[model samples]
Target chain A: MFVILVYDTAAERNPTVLMTCRRYLHRTQRSVFQGELTAAQYRELTSALSTAIDPEYDSIVTYTARSPGMIDSTTIGVHLGGPGDIL
Target chain B: MFVILVYDTAAERNPTVLMTCRRYLHRTQRSVFQGELTAAQYRELTSALSTAIDPEYDSIVTYTARSPGMIDSTTIGVHLGGPGDIL
Candidate 1:
């Protein structure tokens, strides 16, 4: 699935969340990441995030697409970074 | 619909896109916005964005949720801002 994960966490936890996400997706923005993942990879990513986050404090929104055409990605400004670049 | 819009455009167009989007949704981050919109409102928002964006150079991803229950929003850290904030 194609996943776009955006997160908001405590400043202290922010680095860990960012690190964890970068391992599985491309960091598109300070708190956003997106990339493709297999079902198993998705599960693994979520499981790892579970430990990195404090369920009560952080927010993560994951958009999943079964195919590349499932969601449209529109850009409006200069590309800060591409999906291939590791944070 | 509930929409999550993320954009990456040229630096010059970035401010315009951000300003345009802020008129419609809460600016959760530097390049991300999200909010609820009626069908007509969605159309209007898109129309405005169309003119604000250079299709060839900018990118925008809008995630629409028909209902609040349709998607899971998980939180992990201190809330920088809520959807209520205008910008």
Candidate 2:
């Protein structure tokens, strides 16, 4: 399945969170990440994130789309980042 | 369609971004928003966000799901917020 993961962590922990996500997904926005991942990879990604952030105040939400074709994205202003093929 | 909007803006502009999102979607995370909306409402959301943010730096990405039923979400850490019904 394809997943869109959005996170909000403390400024100091943000780098760790972003690095973990980049290992499995594309950094489509400063706080948003998306890409295809198998169920196992998704589990791994979540597991890594759980350790990288402080749940007490940090927030990470994952939205799953059954398939890549199911996702439709739009950019409102300047494109920050996205899949290489789409760019 | 159901929409998930994620934003990353300067601290000074964050409130404007969140407020605009709240007008049309349920904020499910510190920087992420999601909800079902008519096509027109979606248009309005993009317009308001466009006017409220600085494209040169602010990043806003919208993901569209054909239907609300199609969205599957997972929270790895403590939930910060979500739709009132789901809460």
lDDT of candidate 2 over B1-87, digit per residue (tens):
999888878899998787778888887887778888999999998999999998888888899988977879888666866778232
Candidate 2: share of reference interface contacts reproduced = 0.79
Comparing to the true complex, what docking class would candidate 1 get?
A: acceptable
> What TM-score against the true fold does each predicted structure earn?
0.62, 0.89
Model 1, which residues run further than 4 Å from truth?
B1-3, B7-87
Clashing pairs in 2: none
lDDT agreement with native, every candidate = 0.72, 0.85
TM-score of chain B of 1: 0.85
Q: Report i-RMS for every model.
A: 5.0, 1.4
User: Residues A1-87, candidate 1, lDDT per residue (tens digit)?
Assistant: 777788867799888888888888887655668888898998898888888888777666676767544555544344545666965
- lDDT tens per residue, model 1, B12-71: 988877888888888765566778889798788878888888877776666676754454
